[model samples]
Target: MATRATARPRSIDFNAAELMVKTIKGLTMDAVQKANSGHPGMPMGCADLATVLWTEFLVHDPSDPQWFDRDRFVLSAGHGSMLLYSLLHLTGYDLPMSELQNFRQWGSKTAGHPEYGHTPGVDVTTGPLGSGFAAGVGMALAERFLAARYNKPKHRIIDHMTFGVVSDGDLMEGIAAEAASLAGHLGLGKLIYLYDDNHISIDGATDISFGEDVAKRFEAYGWHVQRIDGHDHPSIREAIASARDDERRPSLICCRTTIAKGSPNKANTSASHGAPLGADEVAATKEAMGWPADPFHVPEDLRYALGEQMPEHAQNREDWDARLIAYREAHPELAAELALLIAGELPSQTFAGFDALLEGFEVGGAIASRKASHKILSKLAANHPTLLGGSADLAGSNGVLLPDTPGQSAAHPEGRNLHFGVREHGMAGVCNGMALHGGVRPFDATFLVFSDFMRGAVRLAALMNLPVVHVLTHDSFWLGEDGPTHQPIEHAMSLRLIPNLYVIRPGDAHETLGAWRLAMERKHGPTALLLTRQNLPTLAESRAEDVARGAYVLLDPAGEGDLDGIFIATGSELALAREAALRLAEQGERIRVVSMPCWEAFAEQDAAYRESVLPPSVGRERHLAVEAGSTLGWERYADHVHGIDHFGASAPAEVLAEKFGFTVEGVIERWAQIR
Candidate 1:
């Protein structure tokens, strides 16, 4: 039961800041005490910093939370959601006092953690440590990119900073390290983070595990570092002002403070980190702070101060709106383009040219689907100004580089191509931040096997229904000679299991284009495109439009001998299914080949459309599926599934294919035994 020194004495010149901080502390204490759940120490510890930033420095309009130029705020330590809720309520966002009273209760807007779309003023949904920290880097990157592309020398339209409060746990996570390194390397100076350097963790003391000099570490990463007293308003204000003055590097302000600022017994102890202060301690803590005894009581003076500031904040937005009108009149063409991007709308020409783009593509010979993806992405980048892309040090292998565009860095912020280095998890988190920012459509690439590292970000993107594209290549055991480590045997099926994720493994060059179209057009959720290392022959019967239906017949039995069997396949296996169907045709065992590119999309179709693709009259035993991956979930569509349940071994592509029974003769032999 370690205790911190009582809060340092201060002068009486900052009554407004003191009252605001006390109001936040009272609200957070009452909410956690009522729920009897959630972490309280963090909100109480960071309340003063939050109060100064929100009331004085933060440029936001309660009337319009979506104002494009509003400074973005993220709580990397989101376990303290009541802090954000209290600020939103005090600042007159749509959040009311009743919602704070019902905090952490079922069906309330205030959940255990802050969810982005669930709460107003919550820019990014953050619960897993380090996610919000990394995402803020993404938001800062977006701001720089947009400013370079749209803003003129005289008219700086997209100038806003991304601010976040990161805890000790956040800095400890590896994802934060990766993102911080990238942000510093790119010199994203508009990004600023306040570190809650409380020397306590849930395990008691951070000295037991985290013992690094955080300021020196961030400085080594090329960040502008500052140290400040978390409880001192003037010190915090000066630190932020100094950070803003430095324009070449991102800022990390280490704020040293107690975990529970005023608690009599639990302040600065791990006991207060999670559990609420007991009812008796809560009363005593209030008395110590010189506050009222009533729960959830917002002081009259505090409310009055906020009321006086509300109209001024709203008026700022009105002034910005007027400036925008003048800027639009001065530059109508650029203004139109900016307006379309802000609205997330594609141009009419791009929409009408979709058919021509599909029709103009030519696949004269077999090629790897990854190459096909590169071609589609290159064309998409040329046409859509908002389409931004990058890869995690696998751009050459994953084929994500767009021609005629320089890589995005400090020198060339307007470039659409991003080089995210070898940080797959960080790249995914950053992409989520870009999607949440809403001006650009962001996509990142990596080997399909590495998707495991970034699964948390992918899950969060789906939960938020972000329109992010994930291009994953080297999709199967066919990525030979790299051993089982690089081979992706179960990646596709595992990704499909995540709700609201559109998993598409296209079969050929044409289908690859179709997959990109679906990913670009999607607005409600994230999409994952799994591509191949092995070359797949294009089928003459394959059509891009059929892909939207999820599955369609690619080849039917000659003379239609009552449809004795069916072969279902996806990605490179579609070519294998065709070979198998041809072999069976010679035996008079007529078979139909169906290319199921996206199982989730197919499942979404009406029952009539689904039944048309795989008729009920066809016996379950007669339906055979061939995919070079895990057999899990195949039972929903196929009776007999030929897949690799075991890990792959080191070998050339041909040897691995023969050993795994994936060839023309091998398919014939397997079908003979099944029949």
Candidate 2:
């Protein structure tokens, strides 16, 4: 672990702290009651734990929420968003009281769940239980990597920790389990989670569905585990301090408490889990805790106590600024690179040699897009130091292996390549975390068929508009012998449905280079590159520069009297469309072939640009779409579609292509009927 400057000690007034917890609980209850919808039990139950963290241990400057070195706080149990909202409001973040009052309402920052960019203090958008837990691991991993790269002997510029509040529901999620196992294996010492082990869940007591020893489970996974009383302020502080001191393994502190801790009647029951407490119950609960009965009432003493800590919090940011200046003076070259990364800006010359790299690919020579992607990625990673990623246990197959780069591990925290094992879901979630952390661009690879395993995280990445690259190889059934189980039938179309996600299936080596360029250049939202296992012939007419237009005319009738029909294709099928057009032209049939790599990117193009590729006069009736995957959604552009609507059988690539009508002859046959 990188050495951190010791914080000045401040005396904690337990009485004032108690009042702060009461204030948080009151705000949570009032927000839920106002909305008449939300999970209130969690925030009320975890108020004490949250209070101990945000007020005492959390290293954040609310005045500058985006401070590069501030510790991250993730509420993995996002149903209790009020807990985080209250912390943000109390700690002087820009989330005002009005937003809290309008919780779960339109145009409100306080959404049903914590949204990253929507909320001021939110680090990552998390609502699907285990997604935030997994993303936190990614954030911690990024901190360790950056610390190793930028921190010098006397300068610890990248030092920070990632803390999250997880619930029993978070633990019950399979994605969380996968991420926890990896976090333990990597020995992410800077990651700490406070688990709300409240016996009750929305359905009832957790024991009804979950009975395993969570502490023992974590211990087995190589984490430092501790059990504590959730409401015991002294014990909470002690456990957090111990967690901060442990520099070998990640820590999990299980905080056992009741649901709606201070409620008079609903305190340990399922009744308080989600719905707003009735008016009588709310008053009874506030009176029982000696809190003011008025809704959303924050005591004046609590405000003064938090205000007293503002200067100290602001000083942390000031101290980091000073350290950064000193580090820049001492190490100019490294400091410049660190500054660009912190600003999320790429070097101006990042793609300086891109054209030359594309020129190296032999036109008409056959190569798998996945293999082509590896070559392009190697060049990108060499020029861009912050490009960090790996495969999900399919490094060679997915072509995500970076040459001569060490895999990230405890010993090599600065490694550019990561070995994410076989956890596809965990890999996507971690990449989302890394994107959220900034300073590093993360990419993960797996077979296209396995994208189903990563859909949850992928959706969250799209929702958060995270710039994560998902390299999906074996794009179609042409993967051969793996059978229907491994072939992606609806995966491509399914992924395209995600808003803000660019699903690009490059035609050949040149287009593959363009696909990589687009992925790196896209600063918002995620990109999924669907590559082929079978080799595709590079087209001489394919212009890498034109790829950003999404679709382009690959070939047109040589005579050009009038087009008889147009064939639209993507991925390996583009070559087939071109071949079919050539064969048809030889027989006096005028045909044009269009390469549509990414529908989303093409849709963004101006009407004039799109019209140049697929003329409105041509009409959909004269268009025949060709792809090796599902034919769904092709109707939007083509009246006739040639694609696999059924599962594939175990066979050789050539046999499968012939059987599925994916060859040049198949294209000609399909076009004849359409024309």
Candidate 3:
């Protein structure tokens, strides 16, 4: 203990960070050269910068990649994967050099680029140049929200920065610029970006296509910018240190460096950007860097020498754990909640609070499903420690604010509201990233029409099995004044196409809570909660917990009277379905009306459960499905689907609903056609 307290800074030459860069770069180059593939250039070029950031600057413990306080590192230039792989291997993570040797191989951890959740150290799945940067902004925003909530007088648990190493291609991307602009406006002081100004993209030198001043562009976004010699370890270190000194805006360290730093033949060439340097170039690179000729020869002395200089990350984690343990004893309840949430467990009171919410909604008068979604989400957000989320510049309209007490900001992790601004794409990606982070469950809201912009990220969420709840409001053409551009005619069907995604369009307010409950209960994959812009009646049959089972019979009128056909629907169309059911019942025809909120959730139900809800004996002849938008999947329920196939007309929602054949009269007409 005394030696730990006062000793020769633990047996390393440089810091652990520098060693990480070296090991990664060395192994990266060897693997690339061995396979006669891959671009070793970036790993070689930015090794030192990565070392400083990962070891000294990045507040991470490899053993706990999911640690909330850890800094997030996104290799936005994911093509330069060797850079990330090497770092993960050296940081005492589960990844080792043997795994690095399998780089770019089938089923290997070291893929072409950093893939989210696929690799332990990876934060977001990045292959697209600029999207990762936007994702980073989201991580920083989460940090801000958490910090605002948890960082009390002395227990600062959520304080962490988001530092990413982006290549020239990332900076040149318009999406990256868009994200940076919003990040600047939000005044995210904890976000720091390292711009690897190697000036080489696949086509050739950046001068061929991109020649603008990047620092000026970032400055235009209101970011504090710094230009530094990337290879100068001390200089880069100082720049990073100085950046955190600012407390208002995000900072960017634009580092000017060689693409392939040590590869003698290709060091500064565009050829070094993507393709692997050949045997001769690699050999020449090794010799030029004064490295020995032996293959995979990370000199024993060099290993010890490098190891001596690095920080002891394991020790750091131990200390942090000790501090957290102390925090636990001092603030038992908060600590328990923190521990549970950090362990990806919800608070004990979570389900109970949800129960209370649904009970209250049942007592309250009927309102729009969006209103119920708000009451459900905000109440649970305020009560459940793990429930956390916000909207994309639509918090006011979406009804997603955490009902934080008057004049009281969302000041704790238990608080659920988030303000994601207008960056829908970034908001979705961040929501996915937060789900990937695995402590607090997160959801983001935007108009369903903009789901087009968020579709890619929603797909990634499925790919990663991240359970991000997408609260898509204004689910159909009823989003009046915004016009066709804001109306989502095909968005629901389009989103439904993504495999493993649960798109739940609840019929009424109580069912809305049920959709939310299902979304939270689910751990396997993502759930998109599609809500209506128009007001929805709180149906007498709607029960939150029962509907949480996915699909349930709302009104089985055939048992009450006569038997004929079944009317099926979701969202606002449920009312039309009930009307249709009542009309058939009055006509002495038996009818069963069902509200199927989540297609995927219903699909997940057992065969017996399925048959029980949508019986095999039911009238396929007179079956009717009524919805306001594209009825792509409605064929499963009804032979005739009354939905908007084309863009909606320029008129009020009720008229548009009539035009789209969503009326009970239209439902009757369609039922008669199928009959």
Best by lDDT: 2
What is the lDDT ranking, best to worst?
2, 1, 3
Note the residue pairs that clash in candidate 1. Answer: none
Alpha-carbon shift of residue 185 in model 1 (angstroms): 0.4
Tell how far residue 265 is off in model 2, in angstroms.
Answer: 1.1
Candidate 1 regions exceeding 4 Å error are 1-13, 351-364
TM-scores, all candidates, are 0.96, 0.99, 0.89
Q: Report lDDT (CA) for all predictions.
A: 0.87, 0.91, 0.75
Candidate 2 vs. true structure, TM-score:
0.99
As a whole number from 0 to 100, the lDDT of residue 526 in candidate 1 is 96
lDDT of 3 by residue, 1-675 (tens): 211112222222454444445555567678887766787888788987887776556666777777666667888888888888776766557787677778788898878777877888788888777878877876776676656655566665566677888888888776677678877877777778888999887888889999999999889888989999998878887888777776578899999988888676888888887777877877787676666666655545545554543355556666667767777777778777777777766677665676667667653366777888887876677667556677787887787777653221223323455566777877777676566655668888888888888877888788778878898898888877667888889988888899989899988778888888888777878998888877877767777776666678888764554447777788888878887888877887677888877778778789999888877877565677777878777777777788888887567888777777677788888877776
TM-score-wise, the better of 1 and 3 is 1
Query: Where does model 3 exceed 4 Å of error?
Result: 1-23, 33-37, 152-158, 290-297, 306-311, 351-366, 385-388, 405-417, 436-439, 559-565, 617-623, 635-639
Model 2 Cα lDDT, one tens digit per residue, 1-675: 235423433445898889989998999999999999998899999999888988888889999989999999999999999999999998899999999999999999999999999889899898898999999999999999999889888887998889999999999998999899999999999999999999888889888999999999999999999999998989998898888888789999999988899999989999999999988998999899887888889888888999999998898889889999999999999999988977878876678788887888888698999999998888888888888899889999999988767989898888988899999999999989999999998999999999999999999999998889999999998999999899999999999999999999999999999998888889889999999999999889987877788999999998548788899999999999999899998899988899999999999999999999898878999999999888889998998999988998899989999988888888888887775
Give candidates' CA RMSD values in order: 4.7, 1.3, 4.0
Model 2 / residue 642 / CA error / Å: 0.3
